[model samples]
Target: MNFNEFELHEDVLNAVDSMNYQAATPIQEQAIPIILKGGDLLACAQTGTGKTAAYLIPILDKVAHEPHQHTAALILVPTRELAVQIDQQIQGLGYFVGATSIAVYGGNKGPEWDQQKKALSQGADIIIATPGRLIAHLQLGYVKFDQIKHLVLDEADRMLDMGFLGDIMKIMSFLPSPKQTLMFSATMPHKIGDLAKRILNDPQEVRLAVSRPAERIDQQFYMAGDNQKLPLLSHLLTQVSDTSMVLFTSRKNTVEPIVRALRKLGLKANGISSDSDQGEREQVLRSFKNREFPVLVATDVLSRGIDIDNLSHVVNYDVPRDPEDYVHRIGRTARAASKGTAITFINEADQKYVLKIERLFEKEVEKRTIPEELGLGSSPVFNARRSSGGGGHRDRGPRKGPSAEGQGNAGSKKPFRRKKPRSKSAAKAPSSTPTNSAS
Candidate 1:
């Protein structure tokens, strides 16, 4: 459907047109009218499906046409990067409508905090924040949301996964009751439903089919040992003509080492993780987007909500435990109907996780043999059932040697130890991921 069909404010439509948005995505088509009608909504759509614009457009329209002296909308996202991305989108779409927005997130120095304070106190038309930082502001008794008309939980499941449920509920207490609440998620788990029950008031539901990797994405898997991964990745990188690639590792510590190894092999690569300060993270992302570097090595921190268009390839340096994350990682590529490639490195211990990923894809992913020219030795056999007992080393803990980053010599022998699942109590602890505020 076209933006005109929504009957949005003229200024809002003008902004959309200026941005060259020709048609509404599936989520926008189903959810915008309900939001325009002042009804709460629960929407589930895949990443890169224009989910941000789906909610941002109607909110901008309301702020344009409605009378409001205080903040009109509060959008809580799971990461600082997403908060910034959404705020930038609002700037573009809200330009002609004169809607103001502020992104409140953690991991910044003093100046950012003061700016956020000023925006909150002065009532920016919209506030996009990570839960942790917003809570810190609220605790100071300076932030007010008594007049907030719309509350949106973008990536609701991710917030829950990061143990932000308590923080989210706390933030909601500051908002006025009976406001329109919108919950948007890439996937729906039972926890999301429970969250909706507590927060949304008879919300309308819009669920698109879970997105599969685009057919244009050429997915390939390689069986390698931990030590062989780095060399294999280096070999693969040399063969690909497109250097716009992202290498995703599950643990933050592996980021720098991997980048260093790739650079030593004469590849233009950079790394970012939670350990990197907010400014550094932003800079690295900007550089990567500008193609200053051909490869970006990062943790799951970049797995969701960080948009870099025209990405040609995604390398899963480590298999993500959750099948959905695997989708999100590769979804970084093959965007906007573009063709791309996704490569996954599977060690003996990661085979089980690969099985889970393949199940999500509803078919067996093609496995390729490691290039023998590299002399990386025999690859680990693909035996998910036998490896189901958890024989791989969890990508946590202190790094000691070159092998710690999967860059050791091909013959290096690192013992595999089973990683225990986090207990329920441990799982509920505040996330150490950079996205959450210290509060």
Candidate 2:
């Protein structure tokens, strides 16, 4: 559907044209009219489905037309990067419409906190915030939500995974109950359903299928010894030089060392992690988006954060422990129907995860033998397979790259494998994931 179909204001139409957005995505088409009609909404859409604009455009339109001075909309996102990204979009789409906004997240300096406080106390059309940081602002007693007519929980599933459900409830208590509430998530679990029930009243649901990476993403994997993963990654980056890439590890501390190692290979790479303050993180993301650097070594901290359309490569330097994380990471690239590449390095320790991921994908990603010349010993357990890149590929010597393999279109329809029901399982996945995305 076109923006012209909606009863949007002239300023909004101008701004949308300026942004070169011609049509509404499916999520936008389905959800915007309901939201404009002042109904609560529960939308299930993945990252690349234009879900951000689905909520933002309508809210900005209403705020722009009504001309509110108080905080008109409150958006709670999962990470600082997402908050910043959404705020930037509001600024862009609302540039001519004059919609004011602020991104409230932790890890900022005192002056940053002061700025946020001023925005909340004074007035803005919208306030995009992380759940925890917004709660901190609420505790200060300066926030005025009496005029907040729109509430959005962007990436609700991720917030639940991050254990911010309580903070969200606390923040919601400050808002009036009669306002329109919108819940958007990439996935719909029981928790999300429960939260939606508690928050939205007679909500309309726009449920899209789970999103997979772009079909153009040429996925490949390498079976490397633990010590040889770095060497293989370095070699693969060399082959795919001249395009932007995001390299994901499961740990934060390992981000820098891998970045340094990549730099030694004459690659422009930067690292971003949760430990970095707001200022540092923003700078890193800015440079990466500007193409000042061609590579960024990061953790799942950026899974939902880095939404660069031109990002052409994603390297799973460390196989993610959670299969959903793998989906979010690779989805960073191959966006907007663009072609890209996804590479994974599977050491013995992470091989089990590879099987699980393939199971989720419902098709096996071909396992490739690491070139013997590089001397990274094969996983003692993994039997080497024939090269599938074909042709004189075997004779490329030092330039021999990793394996190419993939399954499914974007994501899978089959349910993820479940463990047999057991009492007192005695083990659970860690939530903090400090190392899950870092190393």
- Candidate 1 lDDT by residue in tens digits, 317-402: 77788899888899899877688999988876677788888778788877788766666677878976676665655544433434
Candidate 1 regions exceeding 4 Å error are: 389-400, 403-439
Q: Candidate 1: give its CA RMSD in angstroms.
A: 11.2
Model 2, TM vs. native: 0.85
lDDT of 2 by residue, 315-344 (tens): 887777677788888888877768888988
Q: lDDT winner among the candidates? A: 1
TM-score of each: 0.89, 0.85
Worst 10 residues of 1 by lDDT: 430-439
Residue pairs in clash, model 1: none
The residue-level lDDT of candidate 1 at 10 comes to 74
* Local distance difference test, candidate 2: 0.74
